[model samples]
Target: MKRIAVGVALLLMAATSAIGAGYTWKNLNPIAVGT
Candidate 1:
C-alpha cells in the first residue's frame, strides 16, 4: 500500500509540473490590478 501511494504521488507531481501551457501569465496579473 505504501508503494502504491508513493507511485501515485510521483505521478501527480510529474503531471502537475509538466503543465506549462506555454504562457507567462504576467500580463494577466498586471491587467487584473489595473497596472
Candidate 2:
C-alpha cells in the first residue's frame, strides 16, 4: 500500500513537471517551425 502510494505520488510529480515544462514551451511558442 505504501509502495503504491509512493509510486502514484512520483508519477504525479513527474507528470506535473513535464506538463509545466511543456506548457512553458507551448506558451512561449506554439508555432509550427519547419521549412
Candidate 3:
C-alpha cells in the first residue's frame, strides 16, 4: 500500500511538471510569433 501511494505521488508530480511546461510554452509562443 505504501508503494502504491508513492507511485501515485510520482505520477502526479510528473503530470504537474508537464502541465507547467506546456503552460510556459503557451505563454511564450505568442511573444515568439509577434517577434
Candidate 4:
C-alpha cells in the first residue's frame, strides 16, 4: 500500500512536470520565432 501510494505520487509529479514543460515551450515558441 505504501509503495503504491509513492508510485502514484511520482507519476503525478512527472505528468505535471511534463505538462508544465509543454506549456512553457508553447508560450515561448511564438516569441522565439518572432524574434
Candidate 5:
C-alpha cells in the first residue's frame, strides 16, 4: 500500500511537470511572435 501511494504521487508530479512545461511554452509563443 505504501509503495502504491508513492508511485501514484510520482506519476502525478511527472504529469503536472510536463503539463506545466507545455503550458508555459504555449503562453510564450504569442509573446515571441509579437516581438
Candidate 6:
C-alpha cells in the first residue's frame, strides 16, 4: 500500500510537471513568434 501511494505521488508529480511545461510553452509561444 505504501509503495502504491508513492507510485501514485510520483505519477502525479510527473503529470503536473508535464502540464506546467505545456502551459509555459503556450504562454511563451506567442512572444516567441512575435519576435
Ranked candidates, highest TM-score first: 4, 6, 3, 5, 2, 1
With a 3 Å backbone cut-off (N, CA, C), the pairs that clash in candidate 3 are none
Regions of candidate 6 where Cα sits further than 4 Å from its true position:
31-35
Q: Per-residue CA lDDT of candidate 6, range 1-35, in tens?
A: 99999999999999999999988887989787568
Model 4, global lDDT: 0.91
Candidate 3 lDDT, 1-35, residue by residue in tens: 99999999999999999999988887989787567
| lDDT for model 6 | 0.92
CA RMSD, predictions in order? 5.3, 2.5, 3.0, 3.2, 3.6, 3.1
Model 4, 34: alpha-carbon shift in Å? 12
Which of 5 and 6 is the better model by lDDT? 6
lDDT of each: 0.69, 0.86, 0.92, 0.91, 0.91, 0.92
Clashes of each: 0, 0, 0, 0, 0, 0
Worst 10 residues of 6 by lDDT: 26-35
TM-scores for all predictions:
0.55, 0.72, 0.78, 0.81, 0.74, 0.78
- lDDT tens readout by residue for model 2, 1-35: 99999999999999999999988877777683221
Q: Cα deviation in Å at residue 17, candidate 4?
A: 0.4
lDDT of 6 at 35: 80
Native-to-model Cα distance after best TM-score fit, residue 1 in candidate 4, in Å: 0.3
On TM-score, the stronger of 5 and 6 is 6
Model 4 bad stretches (over 4 Å): 31-35
Per-residue alpha-carbon lDDT of candidate 1 for residues 10-34, written as tens digits (9 for 90 to 100): 9998877666432335445667546
Query: Candidate 5: misplaced stretches above 4 Å?
Result: 31-35
